[model samples]
Target: MNSLSPDSKEKTQKRVWEYPVPIVKGDNPEQVDAYLTGTIDEPSYYNELCHVLGTAEEGHSVTLHINTPGGIVDTALMVAEAIENSKASVTANIYGTVASAGTVIALACDDLVTSRHVSFMIHNYSGGMQGKGHEMKARQKYTDAHLSSVFNYYYGGFLTEEEMERVIEGSDIWIGAEEVAKRWQDKLKKAEGSDNG
Candidate 1:
């Protein structure tokens, strides 16, 4: 049975599972309708999303409505993994500004829904550092290698190799909703096909 862990329970007061309409204190639900809005830096959003997924079952469906400027690569990755590992059929309804790590969560969904007016963006990760020159250099090298793997894995098909390279080189790639639709058409289709099968 799908249920929230004790720690997750203590962190969230909302219920994703409510059986039989007016849910009482002890009810179980199989589906989750969640949202990923605002900045991803907030731990509450992560907790809520995890609470929903914790109750997901094989035939369950989870809809995540996304609207964000994106934040924290680590948090985004954690959210992405949560969505990816869910047993439910996951769909992401992306709207508003979807940039940086926001795209990661969007792409992790099994299906996507967005308007032609939505704004989409992709760029390299950015951060600050301070230390000895050599130490900073070593850190930069390690960070680049690690993020390169992350970028390539997440955006391999969404962007051409040239575009991906440019992104790594600190270029910000922005596309309109129509362009995003055109670019991700094949990937979405493949995802749909796999879900159907």
Candidate 2:
């Protein structure tokens, strides 16, 4: 896994100072222009997301629209932590397909909205490594620990222990909008009921 840090040149890109609602006209919503296309990585993506989340005015909730196939685990985890710690309500909209790291981001949001056809894939994090016997075993252990930490972190409040185990053991967990909506609604209802009671 690569370490995520802001590059000197990354500072030059135009910062998004306001929360943007996805629009069909004008600029492409999917592309983070400041970071450039095909430059998807931990540092740049994480910094850009932080800029967007941080720039949101205090006491105002922000909606984040995501359409990604996922990227680095560390970056995703950092973004999730930011969302969790934010005082403002963070709502995430899955505009397209969210896989791996992207799914992790959605899980962090206070409310998750998904398009009719939007898809979410959740699977254990994986990466290729170039090394010899002992080194390979060490890398595998590192990856396992990283994945375990992430599972524990995100599912701590959102999912039961058994549910978390199911997610981890499943080969590929793909959830559509309707299923996600029902689950979210149920969770929200439970919270509301608890508050009222």
Candidate 3:
């Protein structure tokens, strides 16, 4: 039933990998699929995504399925960077409850799609420190400044300046699917235009 000659170019087969599962490395750069489901708190989760995406070929199509309540800001940032740097074209299929640091990973993809009923949330980072009075105060200042930059880097355009300030002030913002689409329309258009060109 095969018509192609032996010298013909081989087509890459798409592979779907469900998250929270062990990563299976693929030999071909053109065939890579990675998924992210559940909390994004673990280093292993970061490693899994990178394992699949690291060798991706330019122009390869990759989709990352995301369903999570979010976790670990540092972990999410690392994952997002990997997604953004991949040579392949990556799309994030987000559904269920995406909250906290999960938004970072979802937004890093070259394209993003969300389910109709999906809920999105973002909030300020939280941490506690125990040390000498001066040390604790210094740590607090450093953490606040660092995390504020991270939030602005990812959510700057998607959220208004006022809303972003509130989030930095410890407010939790919840957004519906329609708003998500609306907020992201400009970015989507730009991506589309670039692809076409």
Point to the candidate with the largest TM-score.
3
Q: Estimate each model's TM-score.
A: 0.77, 0.67, 0.79
Residue-by-residue lDDT tens digits, candidate 3, 56-127: 777787777788888888888888888878888888778988888888888888787878998989899865
Descending-TM-score candidate ranking: 3, 1, 2
TM-score-best of 1 and 3: 3
Deviation (Å) of 70 in candidate 1: 1.1
Q: Higher TM-score: candidate 2 or 3?
A: 3
> For candidate 2, what is the TM-score?
0.67
lDDT of 3 at 19: 43
What lDDT does candidate 2 reach at residue 182?
77
Clashing pairs in 1: none
Off by over 4 Å in 3: 1-31, 188-197
Residue pairs in candidate 2 whose N, alpha carbon or C atoms collide under 3 angstroms: none
Q: Model 3, residue 78: what's the lDDT?
A: 85
Local distance difference test, candidate 1: 0.78
Error of 2 at 187 (Å): 4.2
Each prediction's number of clashing residue pairs: 0, 0, 0
- Error (Å) of candidate 3 at residue 42 is 1.9
